[model samples]
Target chain A: MNEADILAVIRDELARLAPEIAFETLDPALDLREQVDLDSMDFLNLLTALHQRLGVDIPDADAAKLASLASLVAYLARKGAAPPP
Target chain B: MPSLGADMEAGALVEWLVKPGQAVKRGDIVAVVETQKGAIEIEIFEAGTVERLLAEPGATVPVGAPLAMIRTEGEPAQAQAIPPPVDRPPPAAPTLAPAAPPSVTHPSPAGRVRISPAARRLAAERGLDLAALTGTGPGGAIQLADLPAAPPAAPAAAPFDFSQMRAAIAAAMSRSKHEIPHYYLSDTVEITAARDWLAAANAERPPETRLLMGALFVKATALAARAYPEFNGFFENGAFRPSAAVHVGMAIALRGGGLAAPAIHDTADLSLETLMAQMRDLVGRVRAGRFRSSEIADPTLTVSSLGDRGVEALFGVIYPPQVAIVGFGKVVERPWVVDGAIGPRPVVGLTLAADHRVSDGHRGALFLAEVGRRLQTPESL
Candidate 1:
């Protein structure tokens, strides 16, 4: 529903995909893939996590639309799905 | 017979894939052997009828030990199934031990190699080709006694060897570095088109059926190798022998430790989707410790990709026998300069390590460039 909520959902899923990545110290402006140890498989999983968490189905064509943390949060907020605390 | 790895002195015949009276063909797996890497399905070399299974499944035999009696085109099979008097009676047949597979280090002495783990590890570190060294262990098995002990823990080279595998890799890589004159080449390929194409292609497919970058690399390398014969063949006996079909070896790092570069047969013939499926299957089988001897032995060219990890470029050593090895680095979005313009584009660093004895740097550079060119047009690959 909001920027903070979308960020929380994406961050939770990314952390689940890559446990070694410290989300608390992560820079949202940087490329999420380069910031963590995420590969193509992990990336696909991250999209799945976002879909399940925020109910935002990201089409493959729209992958570039949500590549960074800000873009993912903005994309989810646009979808109008409120994230649970 | 199969050399599972460089340190493999001999393999234990775990099971027979083909029985007597079976019609066999070249490349048919006739037997399964337990090697250091795990069980490898040994392939038959000639077309024939398996007249007799010479070695029992439990026997740990030498590298060149005959495992079967095949009746070639003109040769006739014996009316009786009984085999001729052999030097050693076939060892006690053992059932396939999939539940608890034993390592080849402690193979049975009955017509099989009986080298100790320590001796095998030591011989590997000393760079003595086990196939060349005569075994002096139990029943002529090579042992630590046979190989002169380490030189009182050498000052620099002294360290407790990790595994027989690490030593084997060290031996093979050292040989590659010393003997083969390797020439290196690297090119940063723009993979934006390939990545975009793959995303669009996988959009319709199920999550489980999606493609990975490995498939694209294999397909691209296969196409390039077809154009450059020097990079797609065995460099041996001071001569280069080119293979017509593309059997690209994909290097996969095992979950626990070592590496296996198994061949994906007929890579050029497969579609992108099919290539992806094959890659997934190969990676699964390799991680699960299942490798076909022919697949491991028959790679005309190798592709080692540190997929989505570490540095921007990798300069690799050509696997011995294979004249060339293609290396792929992580594909990431970078500030790529286009036609007088700059923008973020998906870029992948491609490197080729080729045997200088077979080809010079000029041809190797062209081969890398051709691979990049093919990747640029992902649909064609």
Candidate 2:
């Protein structure tokens, strides 16, 4: 899948997890935590949602790496390409 | 009968988890009560044999009305607690735990309906009569998974509306603001230590098992509540009765435009990890229209965090009979001073709306300060 496809998948999963978040207007460069109204539980659910929708495991060790939307979208593209076994 | 909330004067009995002749211990969920918000599983505070189920299912009873006739331990014990025969190995052992219903000798709910938790919920929501339905689950039990395909379709459900729910919430919040003499206090605490600790802790966990800042706020507020009794208890009849246990309620907005702040019983006693797990389950079930009766009834204090939307602070009104409510706002980087130097630091606004009858401004300030101090030392929490 392309980068936009990966980002779309992430956005869909996030919508289900936290309906209050406005995905369309979020700045890609801003941290997801700051850009949208989400708690730690919401963040955890986002990661879980992505895992369930797409067979990829974003372990807790990489939390900071996935902070911003750009980072999350890019990392997800790579994970979607070569998913962890 | 337990008071589910400030707005709730009475509730309809939905289902009884226990029955007459059943021996129950403290903290056991005895029944489910239907309020305006939804079904709340009621808990028995005193351990006893249920003499009778006073309030039948579907009956609307007042808050203080007796739902069950409980015979305490001090009373003559008809139900004997027999010690296990240590040396003898029986062919099969009977499980006494309430959760493991299948392992019991007679895992029946007496003459009452024996429906699974999920089925019971669905039945309630769909306005189906479970008593009229047949069970296909193990030991004639009703499971949600199988029940949908068990038999003929249930009659069309009553059209539940959002307007009625909105009215109920408005009534409760309006009553709180009207009667309670509220005093407000706010403090900004630097959560760099707490935030750093949480990130480090999450790095060691799987993504699915990470902790949240809300959990830390809950635990910290609970610890502070223990020291400052003024901010943790119910107010009634022009007198303040302090609660011994710290059951902190997390205010969760419902999917259908209502609010439910159910208690996480004994918050002061729970570790940070356990509290996080409990909050997750509570939030999930609440939104899914499932709440335990104890959670609805036993909150000494309520906590709300409005940080997700970049809100700087939330000054919430006290939900009376409960005298106090705590709120946390957005955690943002600000210019903070440390050791006569200013630099960027992560800070959160902690605000308390407490009853004037219970304490004054000085005491409230101290309670908020204690919460800040607790957050500073995350290791202790």
Candidate 3:
């Protein structure tokens, strides 16, 4: 429901997609695809996983904006994807 | 054990999902085998009861070696005695077991040379010359080694060693290039229609069920392959054998390193949604190292897309036995002339690397054109 919670969900889903990636070493400002080597299908999977876990709708057009971890967390927060407190 | 791929020589049995006396129908996942690629769930293709587990877990059984014995429907319980372990030798070396009885070779009343059931099956599968082999067993029965030397046993649970996978791929690709006369062809198809159709379709659906553009390419390729048999079959025994069904192999790159192109069976008949779901499941399982044996072995043709990797196009080497591979590059907006007017249109580069022995450039061009035409009308796909 909080920023940290949203970030944790993103990290978990990304980890599921690319288990080899170490979240602790990744720079949140860098492009996630380049950092983790995610193909389009894996990216779509991440979006789907995030949507399922956070109840957020990630439109195709907005996918480009959520390229980095920081942006993804921010986008989810902006979309009010917080669970009821 | 089934040949998981052209490169797989031996597979280590990881675990048995079925027990002796368990009833397994066709298409059931009965066991898991570890290969250079990863762990592949072995499927049983016949309705039968598991009579016995032949190979022990963690043992690297050579390809064509029996993993389990199954009693098919209507077979008497004592119909056939268990065939001796024909192909399996100690991983270190092929040793003749002194304790085991020598091969029993006896001529039948009709003058047919006697052979062990297991040896006969392996010989038939590999097209071995039975007459050439002097059976070393009790009665000069032709054995598995008489056919051809199986590749050295691979270590168990290699765990995605990139170097090993690279070597296997190199051998297969080298063999493919050496054996098959491959011709390369490329075409740029405008997919504005498909993009629009997919976007609109996905807008109405939830994220979980949304369709990806890759599925459309796969479906279009499958339909085109169904129409063009030359591009949809195996080249074996010095001849081209066209498959009746189109099982499109989708190339998925693993995060760890290397890649796998597992088949999505009967792709032409699946709805777009079904194909998308199957593709998702296949990619997930493939990455997790738990794909089915049929998925690895049954691809009649393969489709490789570098679109996600940002490559404009690629000419892929033909995976042996399968005569052709279709490649798609990243979809990008490029200037195009439609009705004598030049404008920006979204297009993707499509390439086909086909065996010249099976088809000529004329037919290959037609297949690519058909694929393009199908993409123009995405609803039909």
Candidate 4:
């Protein structure tokens, strides 16, 4: 699995958690804070799910990079763990 | 999701505590969910019509999971026909046919209200009462600044009153005083040199970024801990857990005699100016009761200052597991023989109370000496 697969899973899990909005088609360039109405608890839940499913440790120091979808994909790519094309 | 009480993890859905189509008030526990933690009440704040039920008796979900669709009261539920998620109870068919033109405009009832999402979020985080706000925005929507600056706390109804907050504090203090063996040491420091350095340093910085006396105290405490690392940790579960980094909690007294101590994370890494700015900000938030739970806990060491109250000497009761607390007394002018001549000099007292089980008299004395030295020459930080 790679960045795209991971991103897809994230979108699905987020949508499942809070179905009030249509966030599936949101652009990677859009800020997560702006695109989806996520509070601190939601952010924590998102990270917990990612860690459980992807075997990644999003340390508090690096957590800021997960603020947007594009940044997350780019970070995963730099780590040589991008989602499969 | 199961609502959590004081001790519960998972809860059984007992029943719908509120009736369908009935208006529910904010914080109204509309449902009761029983668990090992006990019967817990589920609550919400939005004023809305219960369009559908998402969970039934005997079923359970984690806390914070969406459990129902609450459409604004008086708004046509089907006018916004977003499909309800699975496991949610389905609503009856729209009273008006789907083909009927939408009759209501459904304009946000608060006319022309246009608060920024960010402002609204901040208000929520701080639990500010939006209804009390006189908004400054074009639509009379509350701006961030327009939100009440402090947490809403009403006066206790009766004399000799103790709130739940006071009860919790009493329990915590009782536990700390009973469990922690406290040994104390106090010293006086002549800060003539340190004051000069601090004044010079402030002169070099921007007005908004000057280091205040509180920052100097925090920096000195962090430095003193380096000389006495054992004091820089928490004692928990019958053992001492040493912290990799020292986070100093600064105690702030709340308006009504209750107290809060919000930790200044990594105070040592921050420059004096930054520490000053952050300290001021955190202190304000503490008084406002705006700090998150994370901010309130996990301090490696703690400090309390009664200097402003003109206290000549004071010692704090140990906040347990955190091995030590340092207190500062007010600086006062006294005639002292410095370099052989008598002259009035500003002098302050330092007090340290350490866990006797973990810290000896010698170590406590050493920590106090170092703190006095640093207070005398705080520019070293």
TM-score of each: 0.67, 0.74, 0.81, 0.52
Q: Write the per-residue lDDT of candidate 2 for residues B120-203, one digit (tens) a residue.
A: 766655556777788887557776655543222223222223454565567666767777788899889999999899878877
Looking at model 1 chain B, which ten-residue stretch has the lowest summed lDDT?
B90-99
Number of the predicted model whose TM-score against the real structure is largest: 3
Candidate 2, residue B311: CA error in Å? 0.5
At residue A52, what lDDT does model 3 achieve? 73
- Residues B50-123, candidate 1: write the lDDT tens digits: 88787876787765556677787777655332221121222222121112224443322223344544454456
Off by over 4 Å in 2: A1-39, A52-55, A59-74, A80-85, B18-25, B46-56, B68-161
Each prediction's whole-model lDDT (CA): 0.69, 0.72, 0.77, 0.60
Candidate 3 residue spans exceeding 4 A from truth:
B79-159
**lDDT string, candidate 2, A1-85, tens digits:** 6787778777776655455556788899988876665556677777866665566777777765788889987887777633335
Candidate 4 structure quality by residue, lDDT tens digits, B1-381 = 532211122335655645566665554445544333123335554666666777776666544455666776677754221121211222122222222111111112233344543355455555555566787864475765686533322222221122533544554556667778898898888878776776667554433444556678789888889778988987766677777788898876654356666578887788886787777667545443344322444577999876333477788877655789999886677888989999998777889988987889898998888888877767677
User: What residue pairs clash in candidate 4, if any at all?
Assistant: A2-A82, A2-A83, A2-A84, A3-A82, A3-A83, B1-B62, B8-B37, B53-B89
How well does candidate 1 match the true structure in TM-score terms?
0.67
Candidate 2 residue A13 C-alpha distance from true site, Å: 5.1
Least accurate 10 contiguous residues by lDDT in model 3 chain B: B93-102
Tens-digit lDDT string for candidate 3 (B1-381):
777777666777766767789787877667767677766667777787888888887677766777888888899784232221221221221121111111122212212444543355445444556776677754575644456642222222323656656666776777787888999999999999999998899876767788988999999999999889999988776788899989999998876578889999999999999999999888876775557778888899999987556788999999878999999999999999999999999999999999999999999999999999999999999
Tell me how each candidate scores on DockQ against the true complex.
0.14, 0.30, 0.25, 0.01
- For model 1, residues A1-85, the per-residue Cα lDDT tens digits are 7798677666666644444456778777778777775655566667755665566656766765666787777777787766435
What is the Å distance of residue A3 in model 3 from its true position? 2.2
Top candidate when judged by DockQ against the true structure: 2
The parts of candidate 1 lying over 4 Å away from their true place are: A1-85, B5-8, B25-27, B45-47, B78-162
1 or 4: which has the higher lDDT? Answer: 1
